[model samples]
Target: MPAPRVSVRTRIFELEMVLAGAQPPVRRRVQVPGEIDLAVLHEVVQSAMGWTNSHLHEFEIAGRRYGIPDPDWPSQDVVDETKGKLFRLVEQGDRFGYVYDFGDNWTHEITVEKITGAEPGVRYPRCVSGEGACPPEDVGGIWGYEEFQAVMADPAHPDHDERLEWARGSFDPHRFDLDETDRALQWLAWRPLAPVS
Candidate 1:
């Protein structure tokens, strides 16, 4: 008998995620295993984009919401994200939305760019490229981020010194390191999670 053929569902998926309304368009290009769950995908995104994961998040695909459903809000109708597989739920060219921090409303547009077989000896999920630093957590929304940029860039601005102090002297809005993000991912494709209640 022949060796079991590699299934397409076991391949790799290249995705591009862009933070909506960022000035220069903060974006990340990542290659993730198709079999990984959306819950793990959330981790990969957080690591790749330099987010601290300090607030609630949700994914909306094909008009359905996925996340850790809240018992207190039973009407939200969110499916458990941990149960959704990437390959099974999406295909090349599909687009979805991810919302983080309901108050700040940091939204990301995620596109499935390509799907191909996994490479031997290579990590399953890694950041291939990216641009722009994530705005500080609770930097407000895009408008607030714009305001932050203005104040941070103008030392003469009244809030400049205080903003600098908050950012620990300086924050580079355009800084993005592929190696740093890749290193942070480790083997996220196989990461384990406790059962969602």
Candidate 2:
């Protein structure tokens, strides 16, 4: 059978001054109803940083960082990777970054084959901007497997039809299958870091 459809939604919530002495004070939140599209997430982050695909820079996700190389600051892997792709330098700081292959067919949706440190169940509603300051939240119990599957099946679901079509037309079941989904869950299931590493 073909892989089930995956529905993902992006919603932004605005926060105002609810009370005084609040540490965060005010903030806007983005919520995804289901699994997040890391590629789309990456695009949102880059846009917030005032960068575009044409511009190159090193960035970090999870705990790892990668980007275009500079003579002053260099990463051998990044330099080698960007040989043909033009990129600009990105300053060091706390941020989330992601990289994925969309495959040869341009119509294919990019599958998040690798994620830096974003684990399943880890909440990153505020991290939508890629700033590292947003502490991860616990989303483990927010939705169950049955709920997720239902969302995928619902035609009214925001990403249901689109993600399903993408999967049917672009995804290679043999290469990207149920195992990949399980991996994503495994990552999300990890708890936030404690005081010590």
Candidate 3:
């Protein structure tokens, strides 16, 4: 199939993805091309949220499960994520769940805030706005993350030095770099686009 272009008729999905149960709310507002595949959308979410994509992930929308097939589970009911297109499955104001890392169970709530025509001279799947640093991978689930933060905050704690080393130096729970996140998604600009003439 030919790559879809962003034109007058081709809309964009403005999505807000929030890390479920995050204390300060790690969230991102992004614009994704209407025709992209869900598999690529997974990449977008990973980039915008600063996840390393080091673990398994899946999407649950409207009672349907979608993910890559696991060879270990032949009867797995997941529909191939690559076979699903973003625009085909969602409309404005729709909400869905995305869980990354089965163990940590980092649950994210994704909502389609609006659908609008694409703008000229702009990239698709751009991170427009966001806040809060993504929790370190393998830090455990919400409860583990909470404890990790506490440990990192108290230098006197016995585990502080070890945790800091694991985090690779000073860890700022509130640090989130918008430009950095946008830079990570810059490769998505390669998506074919042709303005309506």
Candidate 4:
């Protein structure tokens, strides 16, 4: 007998990150290995949400905060996200919170929708579907996003031209390409580096 053929289990989560009052929330349906730690989940979230991974982030569940604790700054109130496993913290239908960029307070509400077995040949962590584009990083959170949208929509706004120019390559607040997201996931999962001599 071939070691009883163990099967890999996966968890599917429906993550929604919304700027309160902002029209059309950003949502992602993601699947990950059940045993993966929260740190990996953080990466999954970043990949799924079109985030640049340039800011600090934290996960809050059951009243505890999880993130990469700065050893130099011990006062930071967070446990290592690497130490917490998703299966240990939540089950199907559980909801938690994630906050990225503490200064801007970009918060996301995460819900565990289903627990299922991994499909053969499919990537462990990938975004199956999503809606809306993520807000630009360093845009001062929800309020700033809303204001930025307003300004961008009205070319006559005082700072419209400057903001548009600044946001040149990433000003599309309405675009969400599944292929782009899947490509990002593939790249993040397996990127080639220079081979060792």
By lDDT, who's the top model here? 3
9-34: candidate 4 lDDT, tens digit per residue: 34444444443444567777776666
Q: What is the lDDT of residue 44 in candidate 3?
A: 93
Candidate 3 per-residue lDDT, tens place, 47-114, comes to 99999989989999899999998878969889899998999999999999999999999999999999
> Candidate 1's C-alpha lDDT?
0.86
> lDDT at 61 for candidate 2?
38
Show the lowest summed lDDT stretch of 10 residues, model 4: 1-10
**Residue-wise lDDT of candidate 1 within 171-192, one digit each (tens)?**
9999888898889887464432
Clashing pairs in 1: none
Residue 10 lDDT in model 4?
A: 40
TM-score of 4: 0.85
Q: Can you give the TM-score per candidate against the true fold?
A: 0.90, 0.22, 0.93, 0.85
In order, candidate lDDTs are: 0.86, 0.29, 0.88, 0.75
- Model 3 poorest 10 in a row by lDDT: 188-197
Candidate number of the best TM-score = 3
Give model 3's TM-score versus the native structure.
0.93
User: Which scores better on TM-score, 3 or 4?
Assistant: 3
Error of 1 at 160 (Å): 0.5
Residue-pair clashes per candidate:
0, 9, 0, 0
Order of quality (TM-score): 3, 1, 4, 2
Looking at candidate 4, what is the lDDT of residue 135? 85
Q: What is the alpha-carbon lDDT for the whole of candidate 2?
A: 0.29
